[model samples]
Target: MKKKLGFLALLLVITMLVVSACGSKDEGKSKDSKNASGDEQIELEFWTMQLQPTFTDYINGIIKDFEGENPNIKIKWLDVPAADLSKKILSAVTTNTAPDVVNLNPTFASQLAELDALVNMDEAVSDEDKALYVKGAWEANNINGTTFAIPWYLSTSVTLNNKAIFEEAGLDPEKPATTYEEAAEYAKIIKEKTGKYGYFPSMDLSLVLQHMVMMGADLTNEDGTKAAFNSPEGLYAFEYFTKLYQDGLIPREALTGDQRSTIDMYQAGQVAFFDGSQFIVQVKENAPDLYANTIPSQAITGKSGKKTMSVQNVVVPKQTKHQEAAVKFALFLTNGKNQLEFSKLTPILPSNVEALADPYFTEAGDDAEPTDLVRIVSASQLDSAELLVPPMKNYDELRQAMYDAISASMLGEMTPQEALDQAEQEWNDILAK
Candidate 1:
C-alpha cells in the first residue's frame, strides 16, 4: 500500500510539470503570432519645426490618411518651435530618445550628418526616387557625397520691387535689374532721382555670402578642408559690398539690422527693391497700398546664372528602430501629391518635380495677382538656383567668420583683403579641428 501511494504521488508531480511547460510554450507562441503572420505593429515618432499652429489640420489629415493606408504603422507626431528644434534634437540624440524622423534645413542637417547621427538617404533612396525631386533640391542634402535627407519645401529669393518707387526713381518697373551689378546701378539711379534709398541688402541675413558665391568666390578649397573665399574672387565680392555701403546704395542700418528692417522700409515706400521669398502676401496683408504698386521679377542672377535657394528637408535618425518604415513615411510625406497639397496652404514652392509641373505653379495669366506672379517667377528659378553654401560640417562657424569679415570691411575697420585673409585663416583653423 505504501509503494502504490508513492507511485501516485510521482505521477501527479510529473503531470503538473508537463502542464506548466505546455502553458509556457503556448504563451511564447502567442506573443510571436503577430510577427509570424507579418502583421506586427510598428510605432514611429516624427518631429516638425514650427509647423503645428498653422498646419494642424493638414498635418492631422495626413496622419490619418497615412495610417489608413499603412494600418500596421503608426506615427506619433510632435511639433517643436523652430528656435528650440536644434536643442531638442541634440538632447534627444544624446539620451537615445531621438525621434525616428524629423524636419531640418540642410544647414542644420549637415551638422548631424558630420557626426554620423543621421541615416544615409542616398543608399536608402533609389535612382528612380532621386529623379522625382528638383536637381538642386535633391543635391542640397548631400553631405560628403552621401545624401542624408529628403527635400520637402524650397524657397529661392525673387526681386519684389515697388512699381511706384521704380517710376519715381526714373527706372522701368517692367525691366527690373537682373543682376547684382545692374541692381547697384538701379540703386544709384533710384537714390539720385527719387531721393529714396534704392534698396537695403539684408547684410545680417548672411546675404553677403550669397553675393560672394555669385561673384564666383570659392567657399572652400579642394576636399573642403580649408577656406578659399579669401582669394581674388572673395576680394571682389567684399569690395562689391564695401562699394555699396560706401556709396550709400544700401541702408546704413543694414550692417547691423536684420531683413525685417529692409522689409519695413519697403512697406513704408522708402526703398525700391526687396529680394526675398514670396513676401507679397505680407505686403498685401500689411500694406495694401504698397502691394498695389508691387511688381514681381525673376531672381537676380549671378555670373553663373545661378541664384541661391533655401531648402527644408525630412530626415531619419540613425537611432530609429524602424528605418524602412521611417523612410517610407518620409517619402510619402514628400510625394508630389502631398507636397502639392501643402504648397496650396502656403506661398512656398514644392521640391517635387511633378508638383512643380502643376498648373497652380506653371500658370500665371495676365490677370494674375502679384502673389501669384511671385510664385510663378519663384518656381521658374528653381532649376537654376543652387544652394550657395553646400552641406559642410563647420558651416555655421565658417559662415560666421565670413560674416564678421564682411561687417568689418563694410564698417571701414578692415580692408577687404585683410577681412578675407582673417576669415580664411579662421575657417582653416575650424576645419583642422
Candidate 2:
C-alpha cells in the first residue's frame, strides 16, 4: 500500500513538470511574433522644405523608386514650408511623432546634434559612399565626430547683377564688383548717375549675418559657446553693410521691405545688383524679359578675401526605428544623378561633385554662362564653407536686439560703434541668463 502511494506522488510531480514546459514554449513563440511584426514592415515619415515647383515631381519620383526597390518599406512625405519647418519640427519632436527624416538648415542640424536628438550614422553609411559629395558638404553634417545628416540640396551665395542697370549707369556690364568696397562704389555710382539706388541691400538680419561670416569673422567661436560678432572682423563687416545705407546708396525701400520688395526693385530696374543664392534662376524664370540681362555669380570678398554661404541639410532623428533605411534613402536621394536633375528645377546648386560636371551646367539657358564666377565661388566653398551660427536658446531675443541696434544705427539714430557696443552688451546679458 505504501509503495503504490509513493508511485502516485511521483506521477503527479512528472505531469506538473510537463505542463510547465509546454507553457514556456508558448510564451517564447508569442514574444517572437511581436519582434517579427516589428522587423517585417516599417512605415517611415519624411519632411521636405519647400523647393521649386518642378522639384515636387523629382522628389516624388525618387520616393516611387525607393518604394519599388523596397516593397516592405512605405514612405509618407510631408511638405513643410521653409519658414515654418523649424517650428513644426520642434512641435513634432515634443509630441513624440516627429518625422523619421527631416530637412533642416545646416545651422539647425548643428543645434539638433547638440541636443543629442540626431542619430550617429557611422554604422549606417560607409566612407566610400560619402566620398561622392563635394568635400565640405559631407563634413558639414558631422558634429563631435559623428555624422548625423546628409547634404540633399545645395545653393551657394552668388551675386546677381542687372546688366541693364550697369549699362544705364555707364558702368561695364561685362564686369561687376568682386569686392564689397567695389560693390559699394558701384552702388554710389548707380545712385548718382541713374537716380536709382545702385543696390538696395535688404535689411534681412540673416543676410547681414551671412555676409559678416563671409568676411572671415567668427560668427560663433570654435566651441560654439560664444558670440564673436564684436570682433574686429565682425565690426568691419557691420560697418561696410551699414555704410551702404548710411551713405544713402541703398534705398529706404530695401531697408524697410522684405525679399519680395527687394526683388521688385531689381525687376523695376531700380537696383544694379542683387546678392543672394542661385535661386536667382527661379526669379529669372518667373520674369524672363525683365531679368533678361541678369548675371549670377559669386559673392564679393572682404578685406581678407574669404567667402562663405549658408546651407541646408537632411538629418536622421535618433528616435527613428528605420534608421538604416532612412540613411540609405538620404544617400540615394542625394546621389549625383538625382541632385543634378533636381537642381535643374530649383535655383539650388548640386552638392554632388559629379553632378555639376554636366554640360547643362555650362548652358542652363540663353543667359550668359557664368563659368568663371561659378568656378571661383565653388572653389572657394570647397575650402571654406561654414555653417551659420546655430539658433541658441535665446536666439530670437538675441537676433531682435542685434537687428534693432543695427537698424537704428543705419537710420542715423546711432553710430555703428555705438550700436555694436549696445548690441554686444545686450547679447552678453542674454548669455548670462
Candidate 3:
C-alpha cells in the first residue's frame, strides 16, 4: 500500500449523528428475498457514509465477493452523507423500510442501542470473533456490556505542527506539547514571540464534552442515567478554556468555531499547530508551503495521557428480516482481511487487532513522508486511545446544553462553578426525559 491513500477522518464532522431505529421486519416472500418457509434469494440493503466516487469500485468489489460466496444473497449499497444519515434512518424506520446494515461512528451508536433499534452483538457474535478487533475500538461500540456494532476503521489525532512557526517562536519542532498545559504554554510563547496564534481550540457543542472527557471528567453515573461531570475535573476543563479565551491567547472565534475553522487557520498560516491530522492532505493541496513544513506529533492529552479514538463501525438493525445473514455480511465486511485492505486505500486504521499488528502500521521508516510519520504516530496513539466521552442517551441534547453553559461562563455570563451547576441540572433534566 502507498504511504497516503485518501483522507476521510475530515469527512466525519458531525460527532453525534443518529443512525438508530430499525424498521419493522418483513415476512412476506418476494422475488428478491426468501419464500414463506424462509429459504430463498435474499436482497440485503446496506448503507455507508460518503465513499461513493473515491471507493466505488472498492465497495462494489466487496459486494461482488460476498455475493459470489453466498450466491443466493444480493447486496444493495447506498452511500449517505454524514449529516443526513440519521434523518434518513429515522424516516426509514417509520415507513417500515430500513437497511440491514449501516456505517456509523461511536458518538450515536448508543442512541440506537437506547432505542432498542440495533442488534445485540454480544448475542449475535461469538467470543472468538470479538477478539479479532482492537479491544478499545471493539468496545467503543458496546453499550453497557452489550455490543451493537462491528468496528471497521479507526483514527487517532496527530498534532500537525508548522515547522516554520516553531522555528520562529524558538520552540523545538521535534518536541511538541504533550499535555494540555504544555499546549497552552506553547500557544502563549508562539503568540508572544511570533505574533501568530499558538493554537486553535474549537469550543463547539460536541467538542465541549469531548474536551471535558479528555480532562478526566466522567460525564455520567455508572448506568449513564444522570450527570456526574460537575466534579473537580470538569470544572478544571471549563476554567482552562475560559482563561485562554479571556487572556486572548486562542482565537476569538474559538467560542463559535469548529474543526473546519481550525483547518482553515492552519492552511492560512494563522495558527502554529492543529491537533488533528485529517486535513494534512488539504494542507498539501491548498497550502503546499505549510504542508512542506508540516511535522506530526502525538496529540496533546489531559490528565489521562490518552489520545481520543475515532471509530467507524457497522451495525445490523435489530429487526431486519434476514438477521443471521445481515450479521454474517457485517462480520465479513469488517473482518481483519477486509479492514486491512480498506485501510491500505485510506489514511484510517483497521480496528482488527491482527490487521493492526501488520508491519505497515508498526513501522514508518526514517525516509518516510511526513504523512507516513503521521500514520506512525497515530498508530502508536491508538495504543492509549479511547472514546473518552462514553455513550449515553440523548447525547446530542446533553452536550449542547453543557456547551451552552460552558460558553456562557467563558463569555462572562456566569462563574465557572455556576456554569457547571447549570449544566449539571440541564443534563439531569435531559436524562430524566
What TM-score against the true fold does each predicted structure earn? 0.90, 0.81, 0.90
Instruction: Give the alpha-carbon lDDT of every model.
Output: 0.82, 0.67, 0.81
Per-residue lDDT of candidate 3, residues 53-117 (tens digit): 89999899999999989888899999998777876765564344668989977766666676567
Instruction: Point to the candidate with the largest lDDT.
Output: 1
lDDT of 1 by residue, 1-433 (tens): 1223323433443454344444433232112124345897778899999998899999888888999998888888999999778767766665456788899989878767766778999889889988999999989998788888999999888889899988877778999988878888998999889888887777764577787888887788879887888777789888888989988888887788878887888888888887855567889999998888888898875666778898999999876777898999999999999999999999998999999999999899888988888889899888789888787755666667878988899989999889888888898898897
Candidate 2 colliding pairs: none
Ranking by TM-score: 3, 1, 2
In model 1, the runs with Cα more than 4 Å from the true position are: 1-38
Off by over 4 Å in 2: 1-39, 51-53, 142-146, 276-279, 282-286, 362-385, 388-393
Clash pairs, model 3 backbone: none
Candidate 3 runs further than 4 Å off: 1-39
lDDT of 2 by residue, 1-433 (tens): 1223323433443454344434533231111112344556657788988753646777789889988887667778889778777667765554445677888866566556656667776656787887777666766677667676787766556677888888888999778887877888998898888888776566565666656666667655665456677888777866876777777888876667877777777777777787644435455666686556677656676765555544667888765666787887787788888888876664566777788777655544544444334534544454555444444544555666777887877788888888888888887787666
Clashes of each: 0, 0, 0
